[model samples]
Target chain A: MSNHAFIVYKKEIKDMVRDRRMLIAAFGFALLMPVMMGVLYLVSKDSEAEARNTMLALSNIHQAPGLVAFMEKREIDVVEFEGNIVPEELPGKADALLFLPDNYGEMIKQGKVVIGRLYVDENTKLGIQRGREIGSAMDAYSSYVAGIRLLARGVPAAVASPIITSSYDLGNAGFFRQFMGNMILMMMLMAPFVGGLVVAVDTLAGERERHSMQPLLAQPVTARSVILGKLAMVSTFSIVSSLLSVTTLLIAISFIPAGTLPFAVYVNAHTVPLIFIQLIPFSILIAATQLFISIQVKSYKEGQSYISMFMMVPMFVSYLKIFGGEKLADFALFAPILAEMESLGSLFFTGEVSVSHMTSSILVSIIGILVLTWFTSRKLQSEVMLDAA
Target chain B: MIIVKDVAKAYGDVQAVKSVSFHADDAKITTLLGANGSGKTTTLRAISGLLHMDAGSVTVDGMIVADDPVKAQASLGVFPDSFGLYTRLTTREHLAYFGEFHGLSGTKLDAAITEVDKMLNLSEILDRRTEGFSQGQRMKVALARAILHRPSNIVLDEPTRGLDVMNIRLLRTILFDLRKEGRCVLLSSHVMAEVSALSDHVVMMAEGVVCAEGSPAELIARAGEVNLEEAFVKLTGQEDNGERKVA
Candidate 1:
């Protein structure tokens, strides 16, 4: 930084510190995404515990004693229902209800299969768990009956089932990492943008609106120096905010009950610095682009409105990695927000950080910063922007 | 010394300033006297290098403002019309910022701040934020910022516009003191009394053109008017109500 630029930076920092409303607004934005993630963790934790201990309401239990025995052995507690007709809607008396027909015994005697009705909302967590439990128990009881029938015909019971199937998960990180990783991606994408917002607008449009631009510009300082000073100030604040946000989120994730989730929830110590390094170019890009747009507008309010509208572009782009998933094109690695999102996903989920993908993303962001810096410096020199004050 | 030669500026078809020129000599006070829309502000902006001229050039202390704006700006201390103070900064911080921007640092920067504070009688409010500042208080900080670097030339755009009697007198004393120190001081004003009292040289503008240029007495003699105000009205060809003739 030039001497003049440093002077301006120092003054701006002090000025920003004294501005209560702006500080509060900035602090609020910093906390927004992390707080949202914390709330999500709490809600998911409650439902997960409920799913572990599912309850079932079984009707006409005497007709399917064998099926009832299987459910009970699996630690699924049952409440008996003795009505001749099953209720249309399962009364909210239990998580889910199983309705066995009076003809269930007759069907079994005739060597026929009987389909028992399972009533559940399927939307609630407990309801879904109960439904899965009843379905698995029914499958088990039917297979046992088939084995007995096969032995009675003078055939080996093993002939009925020659193959046994099981699944092996290939991923080391559980859905916990992927789920939290997505949230972290969104927060990282927004961090630079939200952090630099007020400072960028204040240095450009705010100065213009307050009629301070003329005197400030009239100094011996070069236009480029002025621009650099403002950009440096904004970028510093953005990087700090991003670091704080990610650290807070990581700490919050650590508090989550590890046993409740299928995968462990923890962030590696080295990952924090790597994430911050990835954000450096993004912070500079956001600072430059925001300042460029801000200097064109006439007032702080006008700049804010334009910037807020422009933010939707990056915001929508960030979500492409989530919704598009693996279906995204190979060239997505060279895109701006999409590339960052993909890199973040890989880093957290697979614990695999692709140097090629990250390098391309950083290079693109740096190019964006250069282009915006050119325009912003030009704006500072332009008589139109100066005279507007 | 600052010289603006035949500078013209136009905003599309409006032509805000046309064929304006003036010289502010060392150790003297020069004023641009004009009515509203007569281009006083535009002329000042053009000379300050804030507005690029459509034609001609501005030379500050021997450097052309157009060719080397930074070097030219280094010699100028400018107080623009309707200047804004950063409401969140203390008065001393404002001065220190300008001082450092002008390349002063260390003890020199601190000394400059102290000097400006003393010169402007800003000690009482030096540590306070500028929010809710009175007009006079704001002017004090703005003027201090303007002169903190102690440039060879000082330019003020209607510095006394909103000042009360005491504040106006204080500004008058400061301008006189600055001139006594051999610095060229230039200001723009429409108030005839202030122009007559403080200006060693007056450039009277009308409709974006210099209608007259001379000392106050010389302008009075040239217009054959008894007073400077009457001379100003006669030279600009305006009625007492400040309206111009159809021609």
Candidate 2:
């Protein structure tokens, strides 16, 4: 940095340090968000484990003693459900509710099909797993009765059910692991934006609102120096916030028992630094984009409106990659946020670097920083900047 | 010396300054005397290289502001119409911040700060944050910020707008001292008494045009008027008590 730019940077840092609110917003989100998300991951993992050992409330258990025995064999503790129904928020006490018909016994005796109802809230990973386990158990019981009926008529079991199907998962990770991986990447990608937003708004737009832009611009320093200095200050917040998130997340990951988390997070000596290397330029890129947005507006409130919208780029792009990634083309991976997600996603989940994706991400970030900072500097030179909003 | 030649500026549809031309010489106090909306601020901004004139040129110390603004700006100290200050920064820090841009730092910057502090009588408020400073205090800090680098030329856009009588007197004295030091001091104001008392040369502007230019007494005599205010009213063709024209 030029001495003039450094001077501006130093002054801006001093100015920002005194704003207790901006410091709190920048640091608090950086330091706390990763830990909170880590705790959430642990809880989700626990819920998945709990789903395997969940209890089933089967209504009319007396009428279906055979089904009760089969559920117990599957290691599910089945209990009677009398005058009860599942609420929308599935209670943790019972993972699933299986309703049996009052005439279950009579229907079986008369060789008529018996109707039953199973209630499960499939909102959470735990609920989905619980529903699958209970449904599989009930299906097994039904098959058992069908096999016995075939034997009584001297029809071989193979004749009645010739093709017994079984499943072998070809995918490496489970549904829960993929979802967790997507979310972790999403959170990591969002860290810089959340970290630098308040400070960036306060620096440019807030300076204008305070009417300090006039005097600053009137100085002998060029607009380029002023913007370069401000960009560095904002990037300090961005990079610090993002690195803290990674650090805390790594710390949180250490608490989990080995091999319990579905995806491997290869956070070792080599990759840890690489993760930082990948994130630093990305953070600066985000800071530059924010400064560009900030210079367009004349007040903090106005700048925030635009910058907050820019923040949604990462989130919306992450969600698009998570839920609808397959529908997107391969080149879309080279798109802004998607490229970052692809590169960082590989580093975090698979402990490998996709060099093409990573390089493109970094190159694009550097170029973006140059372009944005240039545009912002040019904008700062406008005569309109002489006045405040 | 500072020079503005046929400077014309417009804000979109509104023509703010049609044509303004003046010369402010060194070792003299020149005041741009005009009413509100007379484009004094616009012309001052143009000279400070803060605005782009649609027509004409402004030069500070023989350097064209439009061609090389940073060089021109280095020769000029500008106090804008508003006292735009960062409330979170101390008065000394503000001085350092602006002073550093002019290539002042370390002991040099400190020395400049000390110099301005004494000149502006800013001892008591130098270390305090300007968050809740009164108008007088803000004016002092702002003036100190503008002149800390000791530019050869100074341009102030109504520097005494909201100051108390004592602060105004202090500001006038500072202008006098700067002029004595051989620095060209150009200021704008709508107040007639301030213009008559302080201006060694007066450039009377109305509707963005220079209606007349001379010593205050010379202008009164040239317009055949009793005082500077009536000279302004007659020369600019404004009514008794308004910026609007009599016709």
lDDT of 1 by residue, B95-134 (tens): 8888887888889988898898889889999999889999
Clashes of each: 0, 0
Candidate 2 C-alpha lDDT tens digits along B1-247: 9999999999999889999999999999999999889989999999988888899999999999999999999999989888888989989888888888888989999999999988989999999999999999999999998899999999999988889999999999999999999999999998999998899999999888999999999999999999999999998889876755756
Candidate 2 per-residue lDDT, tens place, A78-164, comes to: 877776565665445677888777888888877678878888878777778778878877787888888887888898776767777
Top model by TM-score, which number? 2
> How displaced is residue A60 in candidate 2, in Å?
5.3
True contacts kept of each: 0.88, 0.88
Q: What is the lDDT of candidate 2?
A: 0.88
Judging by DockQ against the true structure, name the best candidate.
2
Worst 10-residue lDDT window for candidate 1 chain A reads A258-267
TM-score of chain A of each: 0.87, 0.90
